[model samples]
Target: MFIEDIRNDFYNILLGNRVLLLVHYDVDAICACKILQGLFKCDNISYTLVPVGGISELKTAYEENNEEIKYVVLINCGGTIDLVDILQPDEEVVFFVLDSHKPTDICNVYSDGQVRLVYKDDEENIPNFDDIFRDEEDDENEESGSGREGLEALVERRRARKEWEERRHTLMFNYTQFSYYGKPSACVLIELSALASRLSQAALWAAAVAAEAHAALYVRSPARCLLDAEALHRYVAAARRHDDSTANRTACVVMEKDAWLPLYREWTLEAALSHAAMLAPKLKLYARSGSSRLRQLLADMGFPLQQARQAYRSMDVELRRSLLTALETAAPKHKLPVPTKATFILQRPHMSPLAALDAVYVIMALIEHETLPKAEGFQLALAALEVSGENEAWRKGSAAARRCLQAVASLVHATLSARKLLLAGPFSYFIVQDGTPEASVVRGPLWLGEAARWAAGGAARPLLASAATDPHTSILLGLPPRFEQEPRNLFGAAFEQAATKSGVTVSLDNVDTSVITLPTSQRAQFLDALTALLA
Candidate 1:
């Protein structure tokens, strides 16, 4: 729905501009280009599409097409400066940008209004100045442990803190967290790492996408981006405390206008640049996930972290890798993983029976593949039953349990689907009959034979029957009514009823009426009975 909103916004913006959309050749970029083109068509706006061959070609195209193009809308391209320079000062150029940002100088020029522009990074909420330096306690601890304390004590404490930080960072740097927590940088990382320990990539991504759509509507704020120097410094210090010395391997590059601020010595742009250079190559390695922070958080939340991790991995790999790393280094380490995946679902095993059933159903639904054997089905069913035992609805009537049974059936269907075990046939239905001990003569397993007669016999009789007095006509019933008399009497009555209904004489001299009882435990009698009859 939000994507639709974005498409509409693009259409409205294209009305006045002579648009030239330049996009990369990759699938994501190409899709974005087509979307933009569709919008232009819908609005009856004129537009030309350009495929980016390379950086040089892009620059050449920008220069050649400069005057007539009022807006160069770049989708999924970032850090293009030459193209920016070629655009007219008054023209409105919007970059529905992703993947990266513009060269800082180009951004500065645009900010100064040399050209009217809108860029994606700006649309995404950048870190608020107010949000920076909120980690005062972290700063205080760093100062006290490293500077105010005795030298050996400080060194020991810092070393211990650093180890803790790295472990936290590694766990937090998970992709699932990127989209979870409304894609909050910190929360996403924390969650992803937690999940990674338990889930595979595909499962986490599945959940992340679902959560993303829901969170987009319910959660108003996008993840906060980091911008302030002081906040970044604290972030770095916190990161340094982590065990992974690789956290120390990154470099940050800062460019400045000399007159803007003076006497700034604490966090030099040179030091940041040095850090960024150190990290460039290793960043590629970090892109490959280990135990991510996002995974960890989901695990803590009680989502099967293994499945959550799988869902996370199903996304764009680069984004997954980058998001995890960003989140990993942002937060302080806690021994316990927090904010579980199960938190998203309201029920748990210990809750009401309905809740328990719900929890079991959700977990089964979340399973990545059909790795569990058929025996697991019984275990899951038992869990569902236990969960439902406390449900007042189940006590009042079997409605709650019946609903749960249907839910379990759905999960079984999904499992079969995943395994590619589906059979090609008409819709499959089941019939279950249960009766009290006092009604044993005409109830319980006895009713199953009658049900079979109704479904396999009586239902067929109507479609196959011929004219009255036709000797070749046959009689069928879905089920023969239970007669508490002699078997002969029961059979005779059934024949008489069929004859009266169809106005045909019916004969039962050589007709066969069979009955069979099934051996099934009380707990699974319904399911087993159905299986026996169907077989």
Candidate 2:
């Protein structure tokens, strides 16, 4: 089908249906949801926003709330996985997917018309039905208005339509055209808003969403950083105009004037809510209303008190304030500052581990704003040590205020002890080849990034590091710039040769720049052999 045909169908489906938005728990997802909310509000359509994490949570949400939902709109997620298989066999739920993740086999089968996917390449390679019907009509009209002039006019019209279609596709945020990691999901919604002829009002919100997504993904994926920079710049400029126009609004007034507001622009209310959703399980905030907490915070920051209370009710303002104060207090102590640099290791033992990662970036932004050198950058890595199950498990326990402190202490201790294996340089590393049980506890990419950042004296550099649980399993983190040429093949051959020489079963498991898992019993010997080869 042609792009126009699909768009027309989308509009038809959305004409009178209630939208149930199942969005992911990230900046991109939040931004996408906000864009949709704006569009839905503009069209006078009723919608509900439900923030979800992965497939399981989405499934649970669907099962519980399938009755009243007319259109299930999935943003940022549900593209990579086969949702058709996941849904009930007799379910009649129609999904409108606005995602950029790589599609699964179920997405390719056009026969399943229930799922209307508005992605980058959904129109590519498919027959343009408009052109086909247009040609047929032109042939019929040739009998009555048959002349060279008429034929020429038809050809010209076709050319114009073709050009418009090409331009429309060009405007889409296609993953294949750039980094292939997927564009911000909000980009797709923004395009839809354009097709719906609401772009003028929706563009600013869309751009802000894109900017937030870019800021959030900057450190996590270098490729995404490069890909999103131009879009972010353009959108931020557009969003500034909107921001300026809304400067007098209560929300804006509170956000801009809040003394406790984090320095980062991306750490806005939407981003915080998204992070809270992800950290809910760990923070024990799931039982409490996150929206209420946000509103209460705004009220405390001088937003209209009555309005804040009306918007967010059924929660104690004092309890919410206490929670916020605890998080603020716990954030600074786990931040291990380097001696002579603006670098810190934000090891979170009490906070939601991954959610605390967002806090680390916010801290980096603060450091950058305050004390970073004129031309220099700052590095903030994170490490989360395993606290006792009773402390880490927030759901089954109480006295979270006390547990938070204990968790931070455990994280700080683990981070300090892990600093012993440091090998500092431009290509810094921390070799965890000590076959001790204590060393095995520190795992994951976050730990690796923290180790590398520490070894480099908090300097931002391409790092090559390795962490081993035992002699048989080791994970290599970060790819140094010098080893970019044929990294996979080079690492593969080197590891093979090292394994052969050391007479141990050594092999590279999914070797890539960010991470490379090596399975071998003689990890120390393997590292020595590879180091000798590189030297």
Q: Which candidate is the best by lDDT?
A: 2
Q: Report the C-alpha lDDT of model 1 over 320-370, residue by residue, as the tens digit.
A: 334333323321242321111211211223442122112222222212112
Each model's total of backbone clashes: 73, 1
Residue lDDT tens for model 2, 148-220 = 9868877876787677667546532231222122556666566666668675433433343344334333332
C-alpha lDDT of residue 83 in model 2:
69
Model 2 clash tally, residue pairs:
1
Off by over 4 Å in 1: 1-13, 78-83, 86-99, 102-110, 114-535
For each candidate, give its TM-score against the true structure: 0.23, 0.41
Q: Name the regions of candidate 2 deviating beyond 4 angstroms.
A: 1-7, 68-70, 89-92, 103-111, 121-180, 194-206, 219-535
Worst 10 residues of 2 by lDDT: 377-386
Give Cα distance to truth, residue 314, candidate 2, Å.
36
